[model samples]
Target chain A: MCIAPVDEMRKNHMTMLLHQRDKTVQQGIRGQPASLTGCIDCHVTPDASGTVARSDDEGFFCTSCHRAASVKIDCFECHADRPAEMISQLDWKSLNPINHSSLLAINQQSFPYALQFRLETRSMALNQ
Target chain B: MNKIDQYRRKFLGAASAAFVGITIAPGILLQAGNAATAGQGVSDAQRWGLLIDTNRCEPGCDACVQACNKENGLRSIHGPKTDAQWIRKVSLKNRKNGHVLNMPVMCQHCAKAPCVDVCPTGASFKRADGIVLVDKHTCIGCRYCMMACPYKARSFVHEKLTDQLPHAPRGKGTVESCTLCVHKIDRGDNTTACVQACPHGAMMFGDLNDPDSAISKQIKSLGSQQLRKKLDLDTGVRYQGIPV
Candidate 1:
């Protein structure tokens, strides 16, 4: 399932990602729903060939749309294009969904109004 | 510089520098409350810090350093000179007695970090909670922050890095350093990887902003020292038992 409808995501993902990147990088907010990592986790998967597609590949999730629009993105240059599980062989605690931290928090005043519907107070992201 | 002059210069700074202590929050002395969930930005009210008891740090123990590399997925085919070492065991030996002391050193996470000042693109920054990080998106690989750092903490990625862990995103040409295990911190796992992996319990990680924090109380009771204290960096990392 998508976080938002296909049309809505296609239209405004860049802006949502922009907000998420700044918050995560500068403000140390990782619980936000629009994180690029979150998107890659669900979207960038292996096909029947059992090969995971990189951003440069035409069959890649982000690349297919971006290539169609002729919009070049540099996000994959520094960020991991693969899912967390695919990147590291080590069984890091962070990669385990069972051990993943709660992600319900996102109620800062600076957050976008449209996205605030799903936002909850900081208390919602209590450490489990 | 000659040996004597170098010795004099080093001592000159050490002479003026004193022990680092907890001077904030007169009497509150209460442990900081739990952090808000993942959705929230790290609170400025909590300044993360590490306290290392060098007296307890054992020689030849690389647990903390190994843990750091594993946690950050930092692998290197090259030797020490080119390899990324976010945390390394620093051995200090007394000239006369040949006594050896050991401690782990990484980014000090300074309150007034010089790396933040020298970055032309503002990529080098201190998080409001006191974790120093290089925002690779804004970093142009200029390496000015690397030079400005007094701790020699930051390292530049020379070759194309493939398959970096999501928890620690690194790339070619950008400068990076110790993040104090920000990924874990943001997830509300309060301890750093180095501190977690230390077998001797030589390291402590906590919120320095909280007067009652274990680290703050330790700094209060035992006293700690910041390396190169003459610079007055107000480093987040502190050490105990540096033979001054």
Candidate 2:
């Protein structure tokens, strides 16, 4: 269920993310497993209004833990904190569709609870 | 050992192996993947450069300047003196002969960039592919690079920024200048906004290291001159048809 051991991820996730950013930005490497977009797509939670939350939102995954640990997250100053689809349609177009589809498949299978809520809300809106 | 015990031992060994493999596979795969893409990294093998035919440049034509502003989302919020001008059109006239010419000037992207040398924080740097860039993350807002640059290329962000492009992230209190459209270059685009916007083909962008490249061929055939060549910066940008 976890990408890595919870203890390891908790302790070294920032280092891992920083390393990934350097590789992706400086070296032009994309579609890596430690991508920030991939993490946001999986870990982002919706608010009571059924909209994906922003980084400043109280219960947002990264912010919630970072706040508890007294660590300030500066990434969202330039990067979108929510899922790609929620941020910009242009981003959705630019994203590698193969990675998107594969991540979607894995997300559906592994995190059915989150997927079901999103699906049900989408379907309800479609019916209306 | 009994058959049942032997079977159980085999299962335990297999499970342990699988666990180890699963735990180690991602790191190994990541390394392989990085190696596979290392060829895509910017390298000294190809130094990207520009050739500007100043004779072809039209006076009163600000297309290149306008295009750069639009591309990088730079606006003159504070007046011309304080605003960032990544690229500017310069007009030169011969005092003795009455000869006149117009040209665009920007960061020279020098081989031995003074800005890179003068920056105490090492934020001003030249990439492997000969592109000069300011790593804003480490820039401490000192204007040493600005003072060091002979072309007067670097600009210090004096005001807050809003509605910034995600690809070209600009912030307050950072020295920035023409990155030679590095984001576009990294995305595999060969031309900069100025080059693309030049209707008269006044600007050319290509790999200077490649003899077959248009910029290189132009430089060789016509003999381009670098601005302030006496300084021996070996600038990536070359100019042609300017009255001496």
Candidate of highest TM-score: 1
If you superpose only chain B onto the true chain B, what TM-score does each candidate give? 0.84, 0.84
Off by over 4 Å in 2: A1-11, A24-61, A76-128, B1-40
lDDT of 2 by residue, A30-96 (tens): 5566767778778886768877766787778888888888888667654556664554434322321
**Candidate maximizing lDDT:** 1
* Tens digits of lDDT, candidate 1, B138-219: 8999999988887778889987776678888888889999999999987778898888999999999999999999999999
Residues A1-128, candidate 1: write the lDDT tens digits: 87899999999999999977876787776667788999999998888987799889998999998998999998887788888877665454453221101111111221121122123221121111
Going through the candidates in the order shown, the clash numbers are: 3, 0
Name model 1 segments beyond 4 Å from true.
A90-128, B1-38
Model 1: lDDT to the true structure? 0.76
Which 10-residue window of candidate 1 chain B scores lowest in summed lDDT? B25-34
Native-vs-model 2 lDDT? 0.72
* Candidate 2 CAPRI classification by DockQ: incorrect
